[model samples]
Structures are given as structure tokens and as C-alpha cells.
Target: MQNAVLAKVPYGEEGCAEQHDSDLTAVIIDDCRPDLSLQRFALQANGRFKEIVEFNSPVRALEAFATKSLAADLILVDFRMPWMTGPEFILAYERLAASYKPTPHIVLLSAMPGAELKAYEINSRLLLAVCPKPVSLDTIETIVGKIQPDQ
Candidate 1:
């Protein structure tokens, strides 16, 4: 999976200059494979992606980050997991990502209502938005395409 991710992107190294048109790298962390697949499809349909990496476990994803085996322009995280909740992952990422010159933007995905999800006490400049689960093409285009109004 790692090899595939690295190979699929046009640019090989981080901060490479081959970026254009569709150069965004996104990391998706979700325990549900179906959700991951659907989200991946939606993101691909958005046409702004260079690479997309998926992790089923926060522990493993953190390990990848610690080892510098991962780099991303955006990260989409599910709010509930057996190992670590979305807020916990965001906090851990905050601690681990201090050295990153341009840390990845994050979007939290939850089954909860938007209002309820927004109430999560996540303090990070990296957080862009909290989106509802079962990602769709509209969700990808509207929320992700702009990636603005950073929260």
C-alpha cells in the first residue's frame, strides 16, 4: 500500500517542484474500509489529488508520521475508532507535527451532527473543518475544493 501510494503520485519527494494542476496529497484515517473506499472515490472524483493514503489505525498512522514515512497536504480523520478518538489523534498529531514546516490541514468526519462535531475542543491551526460522515461528491467539492475558512 505504501509503495502504491508513493508510486501513484507524480512527484516523488516532499516539496518537489513537479506540483501543478493536481498535486495535493491527502491522508485518510478510517477503521471502516468501505468508508475509506468511498471517500477515496469521492476525493478522486474531485480531481485535485496527487496521492491519497489510508490508515486503519491511528497508532500505525502515528508511527508512519514519526518515521517520516508519510507526508500530506490534507488529512481526513474519522471521529471514532477503537484505538484512538479523532480528538486524541488530532492532539497527538499536534505534538508530533511541530517540526513540519507546513503541517497538513485536517478535517474531522463524524456520524454526529455538524453542530455536535464542531463542539469538539480541538485546538490546532491545522484543523480546517469538521464534516459529516458518509462522504459524498458534494462534500468533497464544496468543503474540500476550497479548503478555506480554516478553522
Candidate 2:
């Protein structure tokens, strides 16, 4: 029953209506790793959304969000960025999207072990998942679980 209820939540690619940009539109925000490479990895992750945008800088990411259209189905933000931390980025993103009628899905990806604590300190519910470093194909599969509908 709980799973059924969770299926209706819009925390991921599942359970949500068809977005305007439904071709796996995603944003990869990572400073340490190569965005293009990570984007390709995400594409092969077998998720509902696709990787479309990649940003190595969190500040540029915020600018992209402000200047460009909010068409991304998911955002994979890395932790421990130079300009802004992952949590900070999320906070800023949330504030930026507050004006929007509905917020989009965001996934925080980090290699640091302490990233979890930061995520919990902020809005635990804002992030759909926290993917650790050394991401693998199998790990991606494991993380890309069944999408549940928004309750």
C-alpha cells in the first residue's frame, strides 16, 4: 500500500505526466568529471529521461537555468563544487523555481561521503537520489529504480 501511494509521487521519471521535453532531457552539473562523458553514462542508465544539458560549473548551471528554458526532466548535480556546493546549488535552484507553478525533479550526485549529511540537512525530500562516486553501469541501473507517481 505504501508503495502504491509512493507510485503516485512525482519524485522521479515515473508517475509524472509527459513533460514538454520528454526525450530524456536532463542536466549534468559536475565540475570534477567530464560532463559529456557523464552525460553519456546517464543516457545509458536506462532511465525515462535523457541527458541533454551538461554544466561543469554550478554558477554556469544556475545561469543556464535562468537564461534557458526549464525543459530538463532531471538534474544530476555534483557535490563539493568550487563556486557553490551541491546543497547550495539545490537551495538556489529551489529558490529560483519557487516562482514556477511546479518544481522539476532534481538528483544530487556526489563522490564525497559527507554529501549525504548535507542532503539531509537541507530538504531531505527535495532530492530524489544521492549517487555516490565511482559510478558504474550496474550502479546506475540500481539507482534508476521504478518511477512512482506523485501522490
Candidate 3:
């Protein structure tokens, strides 16, 4: 149950150029601590997200969303969890976002072979993309690239 925020600092010449690029906020919800850590590490390594928040419980993530404290440019959720499944979380998240102006991009991560495609079919606009479990850096980069900065 480790909840933490990882703020990436811009560094080096390349980092300096992208310092003012975009302030992308990302939220990650995964029941497995190790998996969450791995996702966070990959995102940090990519250096695209300005702020990354991690939650080990989907329920807690929903609670934060209810309180309007879980706003993000992109959201990464695990497919299966104790309190809610990925689809259930997406449903709740869409309901919450309906009242807001701009909706955040949602990405589902699962070990299921066709989970990503199924999720896209469920909610094409709300869901940006899906990545396989044990997420690879390339997969993450592809997803991140698809997300446009919040305007």
C-alpha cells in the first residue's frame, strides 16, 4: 500500500529543451506493488510525464477521483484488481469525467491477450490505448506519444 508521487526533474541539454514542452500529469493504479513500480520507472525513464502518481488500490484511485484530486493528462490502470476490474474503473472514470470539460486519456494494461482491443471497443474515445502486462518501454512510449497535451 505504498502511494507516492514521483516528480521528474529536467536535466542536461535535451532536458532543458523539453522543460517547457508540456506539463503532463499521469496516474497509475495497480494492485501489485512491483508492477506499479515498474510502470512508474518506465514512465520516468521516458521523461515525458511531469508528475506521476502511483496507487496500489483501484478503490483508492476512484476515491481520489470522486474528490476531484486525481486529475491527470493520462491514466494507466491495471485490468484486474480486488475492488474493481479495468472496465469497471473505466466506467466510473468516464462518469466522473463527463461533468468535466476535457477528459483524460485512459490506458489499460493487462496480461490478457486481447484486452487492449476489447477495451477500445468498449469506449473508443475515452480509452486511448492498452499495453500488455509487464509493460515494455516501447509500448509505454507509443501510448504516451498518442496522448496530446491537455489544452
Candidate 4:
């Protein structure tokens, strides 16, 4: 599974770009088979973002949930994952909200368009938007800009 997933993204050692220092931070959680190149491209094109934290595993992301609440201003979550789906993460996030010092904005993304409707039916408040993968940087930038105060 790991091999197949890595093949899909083909991770390379790109030198870390200088980190942007701003109050707003974004967290991106996706299944292993994401188009990371597209994600990076979108991020680069936006140019308004500060910091971004990415996780391939929902479990690992959950482990660092506390840290997210401390620093993140917004979170972008994929709808489908191996062990935990995006909506499930929101359920867990709701429970964890009691302990979160500051609540971060949450948005949902999916390759499937229907998932957005499902997410909306589940709870409109939990999800800010549902976007398809390979989404353009302009679209992502617009969405992020709306959510982040610093953007």
C-alpha cells in the first residue's frame, strides 16, 4: 500500500522554501494517494499563505491535534481516508474542541462531488467547503483567503 501510494505522488526532496511567518497557519490532511505536486503548485501560486502543515495519516494528524489548535488558523481535510474519513475527523474534532484553546476553521475536500452534499447534510457548520482534487490554485487561494483573517 505504501509503495503504491508513494508511486502516485512520487515524493522528491525539494529544498524547503523559506517559511512564511504570519499569524495564520493551514493544515492539510489527505489520503496517501493525493497529487502532492498539484497541492504544492496551488500553494505556491496562492502566495498569500503563511505556513502549511500536511499529514498523510489521519491517525498521525489526530495525534498532533492539540498542536494544531494552538497554532493553526484553518484546516483542509480530505473526505476519504483509510481508517478515518474527513467527516469522522470532524466528529473527533468536535469532541476535542472542549480542550482546544482556540478553534480553527475547518474545510472539507474530496475527489467526489457528492461527498460535499453528504458533508453538508451531516452538519453544515462542521464543514466550510467541499472541493474536488486537482483544484486550481486560484480557487484554493480564494477559499483560503475567505477563511484566514491574515490572508
Better of 2 and 3 by TM-score: 3
Please write out the lDDT profile of model 2 over residues 61-118, one tens digit for every residue: 7876776554455667777778888889998887776654334566776666764456
Scored by CA lDDT, what does every candidate get?
0.75, 0.58, 0.75, 0.61
Residue range with the least summed lDDT across 10 consecutive positions in model 3: 8-17
The TM-scores of all predictions, comma-separated, are: 0.80, 0.66, 0.81, 0.71
RMSD of 1: 5.7
lDDT of 1: 0.75
Candidate 1: tens digits of C-alpha lDDT, residues 28-128? 88888789877777776666777878888877788888888787778889999878998899999989898884568888889988787767788887788
Instruction: Provide the RMSD of all predictions against the true structure, rounded to 1 decimal.
Output: 5.7, 10.7, 4.0, 5.3
Of candidates 3 and 1, the better by TM-score: 3
- Across 24-77, the per-residue lDDT of candidate 3 in tens digits comes to 777888888788878887777677777778777777787888888667888889
* Clashing residue pairs for model 3: none
Model 1 TM-score, 2 decimals? 0.80
| Candidate with more favorable, higher lDDT: 1 or 2 | 1
lDDT score at residue 90, model 4, on the 0-100 scale: 80
Worst 10 residues of 1 by lDDT: 2-11
The C-alpha stretches of model 3 lying farther than 4 A from their native spots are 2-20, 115-121
Clashes of each: 0, 12, 0, 0
